[model samples]
Each structure stands twice: as C-alpha cells, then as structure tokens.
Target: MADSPLPDKLDNARVLIYSHDTFGLGHLRRCRTLAHALVEQYKGLSVLILTGSPIIGRFDFKARVDFVRIPGVIKLHNGEYTSLGLHIDLQHTLKLRESIILHTAEAFEPDLFLVDKEPLGLKGEVESTLKLLKQKGVATVLGIRDVLDAPHLLRPEWESKGAGAALQEYYNEVWVYGDRSMGNPLEGLGLPAQIEQMTHYTGYLQREVPESVPSKHLLGVPQNYLLITPGGGGDGVEMVDWALRAYELDSSSLPHGLFVLGPFMALAEQQAFRERISRIENASLVTFDNRMESLIDNAAAVVAMGGYNTFCEILSFNKPALLIPRTRPREEQLIRAEKASDLGLVSLLDPRKGIDATEMHRALQALLKQSPPRELVADCFLNGLDKVCQRALALMPRS
Candidate 1:
C-alpha cells in the first residue's frame, strides 16, 4: 500500500466525518463524539461533520468542530422515502446532499474521511463524492458500530448491493467501534481474510459526563421514578405507548414515569400521546433532551428500546434497564439486548409476544428491587475514545 500524500504538519490536517442520520440520532451522535475526540487528541486538527439531521443545531459541540446539515428525508414502512418538507422532492434532496458533500470535500480538502455506518453513503448518494476524494488521494475509512444487525440478515443485503465490494475497494480501513469478542459484525460478509486484516476494533465510544452536573428531574421525584426513552422518537412510538399503558394499569403504587419523546417524533403522534397520558398523574412527557446522561444517571430504573447508543448510555450509567427492542427491518437492537441480558446487564422483553401493563410493572419492580448481576458490571464496559483517536491520528498522512 502506498503512503498518503497528506501533509505531516498536524496544524494543516483536516478531517471530515460523514454521518447519515436519516431516521435516528445514533449515527450523528457517534460521529460527533469521534470528531471531538479526534480534535482534542490531535492538536491543530480541524474537523467537519456532514449530517442529515434536521436538528443539528440543537446540540452543543466543542470548538474547531462543525457540521453541514443535509436536507432531511424519512423512510417509510414500504422501503420508500420522501423529502421531509413540501418544497423538496426526493431527487432534489439527493442532489442537494451530494452537492453539499462534494462542496465540503472540495473546499475543506480533508486529509481523512471517516464515514459512519453507511458504506454506500445515504442510499448510495456518497459514491461519487468518495470517488472524487479518492482521486484527490485522500485517505478514507468506514466506522461501524459493534453490530449492524444479525449476520444472517446483513449478509444477503450487503452481498446483493455490492456493499462489501465497495468497502473493500474504497475504504482504506474499517473500524468496528466494538470488541470482536462480543460479536463479529463482518463474520458472514463473505470477505476474504485479507479484508479482516484491514479491520480494527476500537471498542465502544461513550460520551463522558461530568460528575458535577446535577439532574433536574431527580430533584423532587422520589427514588422510584423510572426513566423511559425512545431514541429520536422516529420509530419509538410503540415502545413509549406500551410503557404508558403499563403505567396506567398499575395496581401497585406506581413510581413516577418520565417519557422523552425524541425530537423526530411525529406531531400527530406526540399530540395523541399527550392527550392520552396527560390525565395520568405519574407520567410526564418532554421533547428530546441533549443532557440525557444526567437523567439516566439519576434515574431509579430505565425502560427503553435497544438502540446501540441508548444501550451504551444505560450501561455507562450503570442503571438497571428493561429493553424492548424492535423486531422487523433489522434485529440489531434485539441482538444487543439479548447479549446484554445474557451478561446479566439488563432485562429484555419482546413487544410482539405482548408486553402489557402488568408485565411492565413487574419488570420495573424486579429491576428496581434487585441490582444488575455481577457479570454485567465486568470488563465489558469500555471508554475507548482516546485509543480510537490515537489510531485515527496514526493513519493520517506524515510529511
């Protein structure tokens, strides 16, 4: 392999991160953490993130890190998508996204391109942009979470779409943001052993919460309140609804429940939920919160859908949690929840099998009354941002 042409001077290095946060917050949030870590570790290095999150401005970012927001699009159940607004069509949105990506790369001329999760880039939108970057002799990498999905489900999809081939040809390195001992995301991709050599496990990257930050919700609520969250609220309506129903049917004196309907939750759905749950004295609904770690840390227990970022937050906070993962499209959450449960870190419930009010109440009771198993608190937890930043910096071009 040839060495990269990027300048050796750290002050001249520019890094660009691409995160397609089309439907959820996990991808974007992960990229932000990485960008911050990279900038902090490599002095004088500047970072830019290209994201499709409509609410990108809502979050706080460290200095020298910035983002360019792409037009929003939402995927429907039938595998089709539409622009998020009345003015933009799907084609226009794609074009706009492509233009912004290309323009950013051209202007910034980043020495490294770290792409999050999406290999083909936003339904294949970034292919041309990547080609352009490669032509400019820029180094590119793909950063994936521990589990994209079950191997069986992910294999055929990648094979049919030539995703594996794209990664092999375009990406200089593939960083799995998880330990392989937990699970190998690339096991069934049919790639050769040489491809495995290009892979590096960076362990899990978690946001560090300051110990002194106090939680507002923890102020008056008794020690029994359980925090319920659906990440981004795009596909989390069912889980939130189930939890609310459980609170309504409580025969025992129920703990106060705080539900955070993420920012992306539909207006109609939010209004409906508010109407239904407003009458319940124990339930409080709020929009998406950036300071979720504080809330999670102070909570007595947690009920959530099993997204990777949310799962990590639950683990880091060391709170007893009940995970109700989604079943269809992909079983990423289900796989993570089951593994964590096997490790005795948390409880898992299947919504399809009928998780009613009684079950929710019982699960909450058990979790609050008992501590998470000892095995759950083992060395599986990682704080790996520094190590990942080191590796990324090493991969940058030397003068």
Candidate 2:
C-alpha cells in the first residue's frame, strides 16, 4: 500500500468528481464535501465536480472546487421522467451528459476520478469515460454510503443492471462511508475476492458547523420547538403535510413546530402547506437554508423524511429524530431508518402505517422526555474526506 503511486505535490494535481444528483441533494452534497476536504487539505489541489442537480448554483462552494451542471430531469408519480426543457428526451440528456463528462475529462486531465453513489454513473453514462480514464492511467474510485439497501433487494437489481460486472472490472477502489460491522454494501454484489481488497470502509462523512452565524432565522428559537425537514423538498411534501396535520390535530402535544420546507418543494404544495399550517398558532413555516446545521443543532427534536444526509445531520447534532421514510421507488431510506430504530438511534414511523395525531404526539412526547441512547451517539462523526483524500493522493502519479 505504501508503494502505491500517489502524487506528493498538491500543485497541478487535478481531481474530478462525478455526482448523479437526479432527485435530491445527497449525492451532490457528498461530492461537494469531499471536494472541499481535498482542496482544504491539499493547498493547490483543483477539483471539478460534474453534477445533474437543477439547484447547483443555489449553494456556495469552496475556492478550488467548481461544478458543471448537466440538464435536469424530474421523476413523476407514474415512474416516467421528463426533462427541464433542456433536452428532448432522457437519451439526449445522457448523450449531452456524456459529452460534457468526456470533454471535462479531456480538458482537465484529472489525476483521480471519484464517482459518488452511482457505480456505473447515470445508467452507465460513465462507462466510456471510465475506459478513457483507464487508457489514460487515471485513478478511479467509487464512493458509496453505509447502507444502500437490503442484500436481497440490491442483488437482483445490480445483477440485472450489470452494475456488479462494472464494479468488478472498472473501479480501482470501493469506499464505503460507513462501518462494515453495521452493514456491508458490496456483500451481494458477488464480485471476486480480488475486488474485496480494493474496498475501504471510510466511516461517515460529516459537515462541521461553526460556533455562530449571523442568520437571525436560527438565532435562539424558543426552548421547545420541533424542527421538521424534508431534505430537497422534491418528495418532502407528503411528510411536511403529515407533520403539519399532526401538529394541527394535537397542538397541545407539540407546542411549537418549525417547518423548513426544502427549496425544491413545489410552489403550489408549499403554499397550501403554509396556509394550512398558518392557522395552527404553534407552527411556523420557512424556506430552505444552507445553514440547516445550525437549526438542527438548536432544535428540540427532528421530524423528517429519512434521507441519508439528513439522518447523519440529526445524529451528528444528537437530536432525537422521528423518521418517516418513503417506500415504493427506493427502499434505501426505509432500510436505514428501520436499522437505526432497531439500534435505538431514532424512532421510525411508517408512512404506510399512517401518522395520526396520537402516534405523532406519543412519539414526540417520548423523545422529548427520554434521553437518547448513548450508544446511538457513539463515534458517529465520520470525517471520511481526509482518508479519501489520502487514498486518492496515494493513487496519484508520483513525481
């Protein structure tokens, strides 16, 4: 491992990150975090992130890190997707994306290529790029979260999609941002033993919050305010509506509720929710904030949809969380929330089971009254970027 050809100098080192942020902010955020860490740790490292998020420009990024935004697409209830007027079809979008990625690779001539979440990219968009990088002798890696899904669910899906084969042949390393004792993401991928040596459990990546910020919205809220969040707000409307209704029906249980309706939530849905919750004196609604870490840090408890990023934030702040995960499309959130609940890290409520005023009230009461288990808070801070940076550095071409 020590003999690996990582670059020693930070200057002139180029790193490319590929993040397929189709739906929510998790993948993009993770990539951004990794980019920031690399640039900060290595003074002259330049990082370029290629992402498909519609709201890429909304957030601020570090100095050495920049992103190229691909055409956006949204998933509909019928399981079909439509583009944001930028492309005629998903195929066109993929072609454009491929061109942009390849062009970026050619221009940047990256020393390392770190792909977030998607192993083979958006339906194998990165296959050609991976081949190009291999030919060019660029180090390639895959960054994955702790728990992708149940083994049974993931096995057939990956097999059918040829993701397993891609993993076996393409990526040089598989970095899991979680502990394997908790769960192993590659267990069912059925790769050869040589592939296992390329895997690393890099713990969880965490966002560090400053001691104070000048933002008045999160400044010293009243003692007992419950914080409600839905990550990117694309799929959070249902959870937000349920929480508002729960508060409306049982205002006595929840004295105050602060709803951070994510920026991406539909305008009509946001308006209706705001109007409905306005009548409830205990509830106050606001739009998204990049400084959500501060808000979560000061909250009494959290009621949210179980996105991996949000779950990590809640755990980092040691806030008691009530997770209402989405089912049907992807069971990632459901699997995580259930496992966390089993470990007593949080209270998982099934959206299918129906969240009534009674259940909400009971759960909130218990969380606020009881102390969250200490083990739930054990070593949850995973500063994985440093390790990843070191690994990438090790893989870089030595002078």
Residue 367 C-alpha lDDT in model 1: 69
Prediction 1 TM-score vs. true: 0.91
Instruction: Report the C-alpha lDDT of model 1 over 1-399, residue by residue, as the tens digit.
Output: 112332333786889999877788888888888887776666688899998887889888887899988888777877688887648678888988888888888999998999988787877888887999889888899999888888888888888777888887788898888766568888887877777898888767765663476656556666657888998888899999888887788724667888888988889999999887788887788777777777777788888888878777776666788999988888888887887777777888987798778877778777677574334454534545755666677777866
lDDT of 2 at 385: 57
For each candidate in turn, the TM-score is 0.91, 0.92
lDDT of 2 at 337: 83
Error of 1 at 151 (Å): 3.0
Query: Which digits, one per residue and each the tens of the lDDT, describe model 2 over residues 196-308?
Result: 89888876666666446634675545666898999888888778877777777778766588899988888999899889887987778888787677788878888888887
C-alpha lDDT of residue 188 in model 2 = 74
Best by lDDT: 1
C-alpha lDDT score of every prediction, in listed order: 0.79, 0.78
